[model samples]
Target: MNELVLTLGWLGIYAPMALGAASSAIGCAIAGQASIGAMTETEGGYGRFIGVSAFPSTMVIYGIVIMFTLNRDVTPENAGGLFGIGILSGIALMYCGIWQGRACAAAINATKEKPEIFGLSLAPAAIIEGFGVFAFVFALVISAGIS
Candidate 1:
């Protein structure tokens, strides 16, 4: 019983990180697509600013996750060592959600104006943002020591 508990406990710790990785990867893809779509809709120059604005923060979050994971020995057993994971994860999720919402709105608005380039702006970002939510949940669960 003790061994089983320990194993499950360890899983609870590591699973969040794994989920986070998957989520961020997908989210990035969506953000990338949104950026491209926005640029295309705005005649190239206008949408570039949005991408530029989003890029720095996105990179920072990515850097933090990588730097922390690299510097610290993260494992299922040593789960709670990096206490900042939950906070960072939450921020990342929120950022992605907001970004996706904006991208969706942009796409919808663009579609209304010119219905030809319809699905470009919204779908990718929405899909990727879902992964961000997953990452947030994973981080929350791991931080809380809940499987």
Candidate 2:
């Protein structure tokens, strides 16, 4: 059982990064597709579309930081803490990334239609990013208390 627990602890350490990266990849792809479509329709300001598409990529960076924090000794005493923090944070980040991507896509599409509302259109995506930040910050705080 010790060996199994240790293995799980290691798994927990890496899960955040894996899940986060996958989430970010999907999110970025979704937004990128919208940006590509918008680019074809717009005459200028292609840079804003490209910039908005990258909004979801920050989730992966949060995951990487969580992974590093959790990569310490995987003893049975703290394995459960590692598992809980890693898995929960990973799920939060994953969902946030995906939804944020959708939000960014919507923003891009809306802005392409009415360039005047470009900044306003990004409100939803920005709110989604805020949630991701909350998860990331909470994970860091929780991880510190694990040991």
Q: Name the candidate that leads on lDDT.
A: 2
Clash-forming residue pairs, model 1: none
Write down the lDDT of every candidate, Cα atoms only: 0.48, 0.91
Q: List the residue pairs that clash in candidate 2.
A: none
In TM-score terms, candidate 2 sits at 0.97
Query: In candidate 2, where is summed lDDT lowest over 10 consecutive residues?
Result: 3-12
TM-score for each of the candidates: 0.39, 0.97
lDDT over C-alpha atoms for residue 131 of model 2: 91
- lDDT of residue 140 for candidate 2: 90
* Segments in model 1 whose C-alpha atoms lie over 4 Å from true places: 46-147
After superposition of all CA atoms, the RMSD between model 2 and the true structure is 0.9
Supply the global lDDT for candidate 2: 0.91
